[model samples]
Target: MGGELTWGLPVILYLFLAGVGAGVGTVSASVLLRGGGGGFGGDHFRLARIGALLSPLPVIVGTTLIVFELGQPSRAFNLFKVINLSPMNIGSWLLLVFICTSVLYALAFLPSFMPEMKHLSDRLERVRRGFAWVNVPMGIGVAVYTGVMLGAMPSRPLWNSPILALLFLISALSTGVAAIILLRAIFRRKSADPATEQGYHQSAYLLTASDVMLIGFELMVIFLFIMFAHLTIGNMKYAVSIILPGGDMAMMFWVWVVLIGLLLPGLAELAYVLPRLLYHRHYAAPVAVEVLVSIGVLIGGFMLRYVIVVAGQVTGPMGI
Candidate 1:
């Protein structure tokens, strides 16, 4: 490990924001495809519209941050000059392609805003559906690439585990759901029409249910990550100790990443979801609760990246 950290907040933010965008874009595309790609005017597709519209910007901003972090924005173009199987090269291209496709995918939904372009909107709806398929895999690739970038560095044993990718992917999805849930809670209109209101509730319920599952998977992956590292010999075992009990990063990992980020949100969501799923009660979580839980998840997601990036650097450049 180095005494001075090479990567700082911008890199950490890049990881978090990129994963969020990937998750949002992926989930958004799936939602649209599930609903059979219609104009965004209907209540059912509101979630999709929100997701599509929100997807690209985070990645764009995150990418910009990374470019600035590099200190020479013009040198960024060098990534494209030589294409290979390297993680950085692949990630740069993946980010570029994803931004383009997601932006176009978002634009397809915007024609609905122009009532006079009804015919254009209808035509683009078909294109939107096609883009949905592409975005799903592209989004996933971007999400996994973030982890892959870290795990590729074997000297950083804490980041060397294969499970890191899965953990990041699941976390990304969870945070994506959280972001969408937060947005819906904030922007949702009080429709006089019962059907429209009901649709909103339904979307909320679905997002909650999905987040619960993602949180559950993230917890399991965390467990596996710890066990995997602990079981390994020498540098790997020593490296992972930072996040274990009594280690340097133990409190941050347990408190921020596990407890606040995962458990509270997961339990809260399950509580809300169970009543609706079992007893058929109307899904009406308080807006405050929704906002808090989503924020917690997002916080947790950021902390996870912070902990991992820092821990990897602080631990040692293991002797090979």
Candidate 2:
């Protein structure tokens, strides 16, 4: 492996999952704040509730994966010692703060599920609303930090681009929307009130529309990332080669990341959304298609992090 990374799958998974955690947290907070005024079990509340519930799990799991992958998991806590300007220092604190706020945000939804806790709903709503403000900036920090952590690794030219942070941030939000849609679809299998059901479909449409635009932006960022590297000389070009036509990770990047992850999902969402927008009618696609789109987005998100991590190692600094 020489001077290239000893880091591997665990690191990639950590990046993907961390982005998911941050993404969902941001979406959950935003939805809670902007959606209609309704009580705990109302249509508007269910989606946000699901998102809040999920926001913490991925981050905690990703953090655990990285910590355990270290030879000594206990030493992971040593990161707390330095609170300086370093990316690691800032990211460490960011992740810690995000985890704490996300947990509180999730807990704030508890009263919604418990009829016995009805009296506490108002107080919980206030707490949850307060956390939403905190979650947005923290979530963005966490998402951008994942890429910045890689960008800080100058020895790996592929990971050193300034655009990587924005790319990951966009992907994180896209995947987060997918995750929420997937969960909402799964949990709402049984029939409900027509109005509530209509609201659910409408919400999914809006989210899908947003995700399509995000995917478009992601594709542009990726192009810029490649172009930036392709224009450089020597090792930088070598790094870009890993994802070009015959490069080692070409199939993964072009086929999985670009095709399945970004393009297909965007087209699928657009197909469903364009008609609804044109006609002013509330509509959603078949459940199976939505499921596939969500799954594809998630698979694409995972492949992106994996390919970037692996390719960065395969084409890195010249000598051991």
The TM-score obtained by model 1 is 0.96
Model 2 regions lying over 4 Å from their true place: 1-5, 37-43, 318-320
TM value for model 2 = 0.95
lDDT of 2 by residue, 40-146 (tens): 76556877888999999999999999989898898988889777878877998999999999999999898878788887976688898899989999999999998
Best by the TM-score measure: 1
Candidate 1's C-alpha runs over 4 A off are: 35-43, 317-320
Worst 10 residues of 2 by lDDT: 35-44
User: What Cα-based lDDT does every candidate model obtain?
Assistant: 0.91, 0.87
Model 2 pairs in collision: none
